[model samples]
Target: MNRRQMTFIILVNALVSLLIVLLVTWIVELRRPDPEELAALYTPAPAVLLAPTVTVPVETLPVVGGDAQATPDTGTTQAEGDETVYVVQAGDSLLGVAARFGVTIDDLVQTNNLANPDFVFSGQRLIIPATGQTASPNATTQPAAPGEPQIVAVESAGNLADEAVLIVNESDNPASLAGWRLEREGGPTYTFGNVQLFAGSSIRVYSTSGEDNTIALYWGQLDPVWRAGAVVRLLDGDGVEMMRQVIP
Candidate 1:
């Protein structure tokens, strides 16, 4: 072969080799996944934690008059001179009756000389020592005018700062939160101050540090206060439970 022909042949061979190398590199790159896509394929899915739920506690009243349809009655007694006679009714617990009449359970037991507080039963008569107290705190005053405040929602599965309970006032007038309390089954009691809410209003109470505002209240707890399978009780000024919520 001539020198020019040999040079031309070498150039063609070199060009072909370069083209083949580029084609191979392109194919390899096409088959391989990008860094983000590779991470998505190999990385595990994030764990999902669910929030807790709330339900009301169960309470059963007594069946009275031997009638299946008759409702149980906790007989109300009027003051006669120095003492009042109270007839125990179904669901007429000592703690409940005392709270209703603004008296302590201890007072009821001591005056009646009862061995146990739970000894009282349906149709049993109890003598209440009168101190000129005629009005019942639970009867005279209520949670709110139109209706009591309700627990609308709650977030109990997060950190202390994120834990919260939402309450709404469905009353006609402004509802005063004075002397109101929020109690947990196995936790501390959170008392409400002089805060008031208007009709059709809502407020959020947190477990962490925050100033008490019109729409929010803080428990100022350092650790997480709410947990799973807990019951939240809302009590009025008379210490009577207005509502209850159970966590799941």
Candidate 2:
């Protein structure tokens, strides 16, 4: 072979070898994965769990003076401006409530505007005036006329032996109770005989049997004549109603 041809053959073989090495390096670089992509494939996502919803309940209270049904011995009191609101319990009377709150019957009557001072019912709401507070002017019950007799109180009315009705004579002149009748509606009647209730004096007529006296008289009844929620009327000899009171 010639010297020039041998040189040409060596040059061509070196160029082919260089081309093969560059092709192999490009193929290896294309197959290799990126750092961020490799980490995303192996690492797991964070777990998420939802919680359930919840509910609650609420309580309600009875409004004052709204409910008319009375509970026995169960009463509620609330303070108002310059006064107090009291709920009347079963078997409560005007006298008993007045004595309990250290107020007078006139105070209760004027504040509540009661048409009849002798009548009070359970579940009634009464506004008690504060100390030194003036009574309301909207009173429904007027004071008795001068020189008039009145029924003041009825105490322990449901009790057989302890029940009594009080009668007061506010007249300037002496009052006669003779031939008068004490009637219990739908029940019994008691008649007075030769009795004289003097002016500015009081007397108690008891339900149970006992001897007649100056300050007290007996009905001679075996059972209780005056019960809770009973209407007692005082009638004259001419069958006229002088005064009336309700047992509490």
Candidate 3:
């Protein structure tokens, strides 16, 4: 072949190689992904956490008024009925205390078994009944004399046969046993009918029901009247407390 023809063929081959390289580079650029799009696809989502449940307890409280001395008795319960215990202040009287709680003076006398009704000492405990209850007065009950009936013995625990309460009169003059009462704190009460106790003499009060005589009296009770280690109170004719005897 001629020299000019050989040079033209070499130039055509070089141009063809350059065009093929450019086409391959353009295809590689088009296949590559954007940086923002890669971050949205590969990034992980945030985690969520939850908390636990809990419980709480509540308590109750009593309501108080202005006067501290005049707190209501809403927490005490008695065997006779629902009652409130009150403390007597320095200048407190049965009538005034009754008025404060909207009760009658007779209620205070009957509840506390006041012998003189007019005499009350400071720091003494008194029971005041709830509203709307009338205390019945014993007409035969008399005012208590200073010292007449004495409690000598108290036998509270016997099975209806041997339970007895012994009482004596150590006074100089004779005293009537009529309307006198022998009672337990939350239990039985016995009232004398028509009997006279001579000076320096003694009598026995039985628990079971039977005939009442001069020396022996029947309480007319079937159930147990009192328990051991209990106190028996002796009240005079006027419902005044005279003595207390504890069972052995």
* Winning candidate number (lDDT): 2
Question: Tens-digit lDDT track for model 3 on 14-133?
Answer: 999999999999898889998889998996878776776776767755546645465453422353455577777877666556644544555678878899877888777788766432
52-158, model 2: which lDDT tens digit per residue? Answer: 87776767666678866655644656665646777888777776566456455667898889999777788788887574221122212223345656566566666
The TM-score values for the models, in the order shown, are 0.41, 0.43, 0.40
lDDT of each: 0.71, 0.72, 0.68
- In model 2, how many backbone clashes occur? 0
Candidate 2 global lDDT: 0.72
For model 3, the stretches where C-alpha displacement exceeds 4 angstroms are 1-146
Q: Which stretches of candidate 2 lie over 4 Å from their true place?
A: 1-146
Sum up the clashes in candidate 3.
2
lDDT of 2 at 115: 98
Clashing pairs in 2: none
